[model samples]
Target: MQAVEPGGVSPYRFLLVAARLGSVRRRSQDVDMIKAQRVEAADSALIDPAGSEWRSAPSTRLSLEPTPLISQPSAYVQAKWETIDYGAIGNVSVQALHNDGGIFFRLQWNDATENDDIRDTDQFTDAAAVLFPVKEDAPLTSMGSPDEPVNAWYWRPDMETPFSVTSEGTSTTIRTIDPNLRGNGAHTGGAWAVVIGRALQSAGDGYVQLTAGEEGKVAFAVWQGGNDERAGLKAVTLEWQPLELEA
Candidate 1:
């Protein structure tokens, strides 16, 4: 198939040509474009869906990270990083649900050692975060730029509740803790299970607004204290995952 020059042929002819010969170069470029344009998807935390309930919702594993990444605290390169043995947490199982005017999430993970106590700078605490875009087309990585911000729901066992933050690039500011946002966690049998809940909309400025039947994107990150995986040194999804609310 011969690649059609833009403006020289119609899309119909472009498809017909692509089907007939499908030039290797053109086909390869098309595939690349598709990947670049397509954002990966995941099941949104359900809203009052019936099943085993929030605690028993189906689990989805998230295990992807940035290439050539560095740990924020240690400044270790991706290949040489020893904490979590270079993304050793493997994957975290997650489930989400909403009820009584709020959305809830259950994140579970297995760790041989639990680092819940964070009393010193040398020691780090186990933590996780979920980031949602303030706007439909907000960038998942970089926590969105200034013009495009993101709302982050962060949880740690040491805290009585999760923290709501708005971020642009590397700059983040603590925002009002929405009365509707709160979460708790427990560690048992070398594993951790945490539940976080928040309203379906942004509480105020620089927050994402969630609604039933709406679609958006979310990103996940996890830090292992035992491995000194503090700051930027953590496991994270490489790209945005689909988030769609059920009516």
Candidate 2:
């Protein structure tokens, strides 16, 4: 019955795993080092990991991340602020995409109107005749190309934002329209839906996992008619923090 070595553990030691682990690996020189490590780790014998000890760490000792600053528009979010404002084309209008080629959307900040009495409005209206060819550089109002045809597509302001896009066979998913429409009914079908998304997702140009968001992109492009596709947006801006929702 006496299987244990005289210098080793006794049968009673089986009750504890530490005892079963054999003597703690201890070197005479390491003894103080181990004790110090244990002191730093446990802080106190009464505050072991398994034990519930609410030892408060010093503010200086604790890892404290700096308050982040979001000044620029993010990929996942777009915010904008404007004191002076005027659309390149008079009256609220929609840009009609009449071709299959790509397109660009743009925005410009006109400081000239900064002194003018600017009326901030959530609802902007456009006439039946859309403000065709919105993309422009420099002064921006010059327009891209006039010859491009106008096609009818679906659009809703402050609609649902698209988090993901995929295709199955010949039919392209194109782009999704927002379900919830915001103020001002002008740009509807045959237009592009606008939603809040990250203005600048610096993570990289890869498919971000679809998740809920608060703010979304101003609008999106969709091809309602054949050849008419959601072209690229040129210069939109973000000045204020945007309320958005994610997919």
Candidate 3:
């Protein structure tokens, strides 16, 4: 299959490609919006992916596809991945909950291999991220434009904590260690469950401030270390999904 160049196709062309390749397991129309359940302030399990509190929140399964090869940072990456099949992870289960303190997202996916060790040059840890647009009209495929940015709460099994990432278009990502961002992950059986949490409001610039009783947009990305997936070589939601928070 020929890889579609970024500028040659629409932002949502990945869906068509996946459909033609028979890789898309489900359509986005099945789950139109992600409703964040309202929880009490004292619920300590909000940040815990394995906690029982997640049982009360609803889950939305999203079908994912490989990011466009042309969107990669360099020619080396494009050439290296031209004939290779990467981003095989096809689906991810997502749940959201919020309280007066913060908003939490739980992402669950299946993986036969648990890659937590990153000691060698070829080794990389499994990772996931939840992205929100800084502006209402920000583009999802290119990770937003110069005037419009996107904020990402990134988590990996090897790190002690998650990272606050901001991006303006492809290859323009900036990662920061934010004390406010917290994450917990656990691998049980053949699947990985991860929870990333942050305050509803922003602590500083480059942070996407989420408000209650309003609607926003969110996207997801996953990197399978065993598949040598990193940077733009990961599975992602092609379009932004609507997110509605309870009042």
Per lDDT, the best of the predicted structures is: 3
Alpha carbon lDDT of each predicted model: 0.60, 0.20, 0.83
Once fitted onto the true fold, the runs of candidate 1 whose alpha carbons sit more than 4 angstroms away are 1-52, 66-86, 173-176
Q: What is the lDDT of residue 96 in candidate 1?
A: 63
Q: Give per-residue CA lDDT, model 2, range 1-247, as digits (tens).
A: 1122346332134225434555453333211110001112221222121122213311011011111112112433223312211122211111111011111111111111111111334322221111111111111111122322111122322232222222221122233232221112222233322212221221322212111322221221221111111221112111111112211
Give the runs in model 2 whose Cα sits over 4 Å from its true position: 1-158, 172-199, 202-247
What tens digits encode model 3's per-residue C-alpha lDDT throughout 21-65?
Answer: 663434345335888888884446788887888987899998767
Ranked candidates (lDDT, high to low): 3, 1, 2
Tens digits of per-residue lDDT for model 1, 1-247: 1112225333334346656864333423122110011112212333222223654444566653421243232344444553334333555766766543556667778877788888888888898887787876676546677888878888877887778878875535465676667777777788877777677764577877777655667777777777776556566664566665655
Residue 25 alpha-carbon offset, candidate 1, angstroms: 20
RMSD of 3: 5.3
Worst 10 residues of 3 by lDDT: 1-10
Candidate 3's error at 134, in angstroms? 0.4
* Full candidate order by TM-score, most accurate first: 3, 1, 2
Model 2 scores worst on lDDT over the 10 consecutive residues at 58-67
Against the true structure, candidate 2 reaches a TM-score of 0.16
C-alpha TM-score for every candidate? 0.71, 0.16, 0.88
Best by TM-score: 3
